[model samples]
Target chain A: MTMPDSSASLPAAASASAPSTKLHAVAPTALPPGVRDLRLDFFRGLALLCIFIDHIPGNRIADYTIRVVGLSDASELFIFISGYAAGLVYMSAVAREGFLFSSLRVWRRVWQLYVAHLFLFVIFTAEVAWTSMKFDNPMYVEEMNIASFLSEPHIAILEALLLKFKPVYMDILPLYIVLLVFFPFALWLIRQSRLLALGLSIALYATARIYHLNLPAYPEDAEWYFNPLAWQLLFVIGAILGASTRTFANSGMDFPVPRNRWLLGAAIAYALFGFGMQFLWEHDLISRVFPHGSEAFIFPTDKTNLSGWRLSNLLALAYITAYFLRADSPMLRWRVFHPLIMCGQHSLNIFCLGVFLSFAGLIVLVEFSDSLAYQLLVNGTGIAIMIGAAALLAWYRAKERMPRKPAEGPAGGANVKSTALGGGSAE
Target chain B: MTIFHFSRRGSLGWRTAVMTVLLMAAFSPGADAAEATPPQDLAQFCAVPETVLPNGFLKHARDAYRAGKPLRIVAFGTSSSAGTGAASRADAYPARLQADLQERFTLPAEVINKSVGGQSARQMTSRLEDDVVSLEPSLVIWQTGTVDSVGNLQLEDFGRALSQGIEMLEKEGIDVILMNMQYSRRVELLVNYSPYVDMMNAVATQSGAALFDRIEMMRHWASSGRLDFDNMPRAERASRAAKLHECIALQLADMIEKAVRR
Candidate 1:
């Protein structure tokens, strides 16, 4: 998921430091009441849960995830939402504190994600190494792509630090990090003209596909799993939609919410087509009609280049979801979805925890019998852990924001200050 | 006699003659001729002990090759088979094996890799219909058990899934080669891998599939100093791994040839 930067929460501070420019004369769009939109958080939370289950490989729980019935899966949602959220936070920042401060804020977030990616790499490598050694299975390191680190410590570590080498599931974050690093520029371009930004993004994506362009992986002569050049289109689209939210707000305009019956019907029909196509593809029925040679041209679903089919499917799904699930819907506020909401609210932390937990879950599924009951227990337990961790983080942040006790005076103020510092470090 | 006379005439000639005799002794057919022989270039890398395949192994691949049809072999498994450590995709064992088979038999060959890194046997089983059976390959080399063992998956479930996968392949008239795990120093210490290996062996025997003992072969390489896992410098590891993959390709080709010929 594209993690929203600290600017998302500290909009007041951003507005307080606003420069007196003509840009500010238009008046900044009001920030969302809370740090997150409930709809975005709920879906992102669901995406995280799906990702956890999918990563476990042969588990029965994987069958129930959206990917089974649809062309676009959690990866699409995670990335799109990330872009949307980043646009929401940063654009609001830009509208308030001007472009310079907002860009710095986004870049700082990129740095934070990069550091987190490295930290995760080290921990994941250590986990594989420790497990392999403890279990007498050095091949596990090789299996998980950690053998390069062991065999070529200096080069591999350097490449990893440079973000050129990423282990298996560690790939997506690097994609997010790169996109986020360039997001400030994209946001600015988008601010200038949405059509121009979108046109540039789509043109780059097309060029990447035509030229087979991608960032090279170090040590291995392969390309990044999620090619930034191709994937930028989706992120840019999400961002543009997000930026439009503010642009519309400031100008007293509103985004068309798919109210037209024909548009809604088209969206449903498109979604159904995607589902049917994916089902046929999964069953290998589609291959009979579209041979391997013609498949790419006819229905290009290649994930690396983010093919046109995938993009269309994502757009259709997004449109349908947006039509059905408004941000302030009572269904979203229901207590049943609180876990997902909490998980979404604390996405960056929960995503990391989800990765580690998914690995742990795989081990559990393998170590124990992979019975239906056991699989359910494992998946259920993992979801609980993710939700619990999110809740814990939320509680900690809430406590940090609690007002100081008046009777305790300076000591209470000092305590709150230390707690806030601790919370910041925790994030 | 002439060579002996030349050797007596000069020390250099004598050295050349001795080396020639040793090479002949190594390559010539003996009472143990039924044992598979690695190609001359790969002899140094042949650390594996002698292994015998059941009669008619790889018959489908052989039949396809003989008919001048494309011999399709799917390399199915986790990272090693998926080309994780290989410098390039072409350097992967399956691709190298395809090259070897084409050259050896003078026929077109397609070695499709249906491996995903970090997948266990159970996961591989779930994907069989789409990844393997749908490819319509004549032969499948399934490198599994490593992830299952590493992940500590249930032995019974792993066995059942593996058996079911092999059964499905056999029913489709595809030749099956069950490749065991690669030897790893760290893994040897941390996991009791013998049970998993034994389970694969049993499965291969019961299902009439050939078992490619990669674990023992890799261990032999490490023990015989052919592959230096302990002290090799970090920078040279990729080259070393590439060499290992090449050696594996050579060994796999040799096994297929022996089976087909038998």
Candidate 2:
């Protein structure tokens, strides 16, 4: 480990205001650790919330999500930020402990994800089946694509263990598991040359896209919903950005951005175009003008294959965000985002909980009322529960981190505003 | 889309015989003579082109109906076919269709609804043998794609299941009429039904099945003021659904008549 005591990334987000920064590999740790860029937690947290909303059927909250303003949805940001966090943490691990130990840690996390996926599958299936039976609606099993599981539990369980029998919202966790398997090698490549690593990742994505290559699923010829082969590009792009500091400045700490007006203008223009196009895609107002569906081509934006439109849209938006909302922006540290940051810090737990809550929310909406006021109430209550759970988990973890029981420790609410990034973990 | 003729014309082999009965059946009192008055009169709902070309693929069903045998049909779909929103099961499109067909013909007609609410095309495909084909129905009116679109399921999966189901029915010499999602302008922004609709059309075209295009047909109703769906109150859904199902039955019966011979 090059800097075992120091983080591979910035020591704290405090250096986000510096003019130039070196990779943690070069920087000496002179300050306290556990600080991460608030943006990662903020955006990742927002993406998690969007994912919860999107998972539920007939969730109108989804209309106001990333789909409204960009071709890329929250799924992209979730994967990219996951890679970003992995790179920020594990790249340093590899440098410090060599590939073998770092890979062991990665595998441990992957095992956790695999277990989490199966656990979710069990809960999601049971809930759907119970709801359907309780309501005397057999189609609920079909809706979640768990009919096979219900019909042939033995075969379906094996297939699910192989990560082939993913019902609707269970695809992302499996993809994450697959991504972590190759992280050791990918991180090694990134350490040698970020461009070469990213270039190889893009090449694989291109080949996958061109050939329509993806892993097949169980009991059906259809491939994985979020094709990992193509999706690795986004993760790699984020990983390289996370692993490498800004190269333009060498004197002082710098945020991971290369500011240029032309690039900024182009990014802004593309993002605006995507926003307008997405608006049209959702409303389908453009079809009305043409009357006979003349020249009204349905955009071939394939989510499964991670179409180029979505990729470019995500990259453009990321750039615009980085250029305008600097790492040290006051909004990043806003008190309003505390709960979100807490949610982000304990993302894995919050994500699993959120997935379950979404289904519960759906059941409530179905069993009760789905009117406007009711929907708002359901959404508000669901999000509040997620936040509250996140805060409690964050508080518990903070207590576990301390060696002694502090006599003057603040309560959970007070600690929320000052909650350190990455869950206050120095590791 | 071959126009059925009520007037006598120089007859071709099958055309001469088909011309005598189908045309009269097509013009059956329908919306124009419907007992309801003013807004309730379903004249505007029946304004669509009645001959949907489902008959081009209805060779076996047409022959059965022509032989004076009891014509049987299975209404397979989700909530809409299962009679959701309507006042009662009889008020659903399938039950109303049986009555509509009986009124149009002297022969015994049965329309069995094997619809399970909230099911997708995938589920319908699985139930093809047990619920629909086992009944030995000559025709299957499959209402699908709504739940799939609403739940954001895979388009390819939906298309594949739909095509497979249609192929199975076609292999059994069953006429298939593919009905799409119900239209609600309010959720239009929330759900992308276009891809599923397009996929349905593609599958129907490929399999030689007829597409009812319920989504567009209802959209047409909304735009033309034939129905007021967007501003409809919760309490009004029951009555409106009854009328909606009745209008659908009327239009479908009209289409069925245009394709079959007496």
Interface RMSD of each: 21.0, 18.8
* Candidate 2: tens digits of C-alpha lDDT, residues A1-427: 1111112333332344343233343446422233466678788889888888887656677789777878899999999888877876676556666889878888888898899999998875565444333332221222333333566777777988999877657789999889988888898898777657876897898899888788878655445879999999888777776665323223222335455577678888988988877776566444444444332233536778787778888888887887776444567668999988878877888899888777666555443334555567657777888899999987797687564335436664334423433223211
Q: Please give the range of 10 consecutive residues that has the lowest summed lDDT in model 1 chain A.
A: A1-10
The lDDT leader among the candidates is 2
Q: Which pairs in model 2 have colliding backbones?
A: A1-A96, A20-A252, A20-A253, A20-A254, A21-A252, A21-A253, A21-A254
Top DockQ hit: 2
TM-score of chain B of each: 0.80, 0.81
All candidates: TM-score of chain A: 0.82, 0.84
Per-prediction DockQ comes to: 0.04, 0.04
lDDT of each: 0.68, 0.69
Residue-by-residue lDDT tens digits, candidate 1, A1-427: 1112211322222232232122334546332222345677788889999988877644568878978757788888888888877776677667777999878878787888898899888766665554433342222354434343565667767988888877666768999999988998999898887667877887899898888788877654435768899998889888876665544433211222323456567767877888887776555456455543344342325666777767777777776776666444568779999999889878888888887776666554333334455567668878888999999988997875665556668778666654442223212
Range of the 10 consecutive residues with the lowest summed lDDT in candidate 1 chain B: B27-36
True contacts kept of 1: 0.03
Q: Candidate 2 chain B: minimum summed lDDT over ten consecutive residues — where? A: B1-10
